[model samples]
Target: MSRLELAAARLAKALDDLETVVSPLAKARESAAVAETKIAALDAEREALVARVATLEDEARALSGLTEEVEDRLDGAIAEIRTALSR
Candidate 1:
């Protein structure tokens, strides 16, 4: 083959090789973008769940306090009934 034709053929092969390399890289970038978006969404969801858990903990503490107060009142009533019965 002529030298010019050979050079042109080599150039075409080089372009094809570059495309082969660049195509996968482009696809990888696209996949990474999608993964980043999903991660951001999951982070937001996790934050919301954390906030909800904090609120539930506060409510549980309040309920525990109320339960203690009721127990105290019930104990006092039971002691009074015992004294009356002993009289």
Candidate 2:
């Protein structure tokens, strides 16, 4: 083959080798972008869950207070009934 034709063939081979080396790197970058997006979505979900937990905790505390108030009223009513029955 002529020297010019040989040089062209070498250049084409070099380009093919370069493409082979770069293909995996490009795929790795795409995978990393997808992973980052998923992580961001998870972080947002975790924040929402934390807020929901705080709201539930506050409601539980209010219910606890109401339960104590109910118990006290029942105890007073029982004592009053006992006194009336004894008379």
Candidate 3:
């Protein structure tokens, strides 16, 4: 083969080798970018869930207070009925 042809063949092989080495690195970079986006979305979702849980906790506390008040009133009524019956 002529020297020019040998040079061209070497160049083509070098280009192929470079692509093989670089392809995985390129794919990894793309995957990392996607993972970062997903992590950001998950963080926002977690924040929303935390806020919702806080609101639910507050509502539950209010309901607990109301339940205690109702139980106290019921107990008092029961005591009054017992006293009247004993008479």
For candidate 2, the TM-score is 0.82
Where is model 2 more than 4 Å wrong at Cα?
none
**Cα lDDT of all candidates, in order?**
1.00, 1.00, 1.00
Query: Tens digits of per-residue lDDT for model 3 on 63-87?
Result: 9999999999999999999999999
Ranking by TM-score: 1, 3, 2
TM, every model: 0.89, 0.82, 0.83
Candidate 2: C-alpha lDDT: 1.00
Count clashes in each candidate, considering only residues at least 3 apart in sequence or on different chains.
0, 0, 0
Ranking 2 against 3 by TM-score, winner: 3
lDDT of 1 by residue, 1-87 (tens): 999999999999999999999999999999999999999999999999999999999999999999999999999999999999999
Model 1 whole-model lDDT (C-alpha atoms): 1.00
Model 1 compared with the native: what TM-score? Answer: 0.89
Off by over 4 Å in 1: none
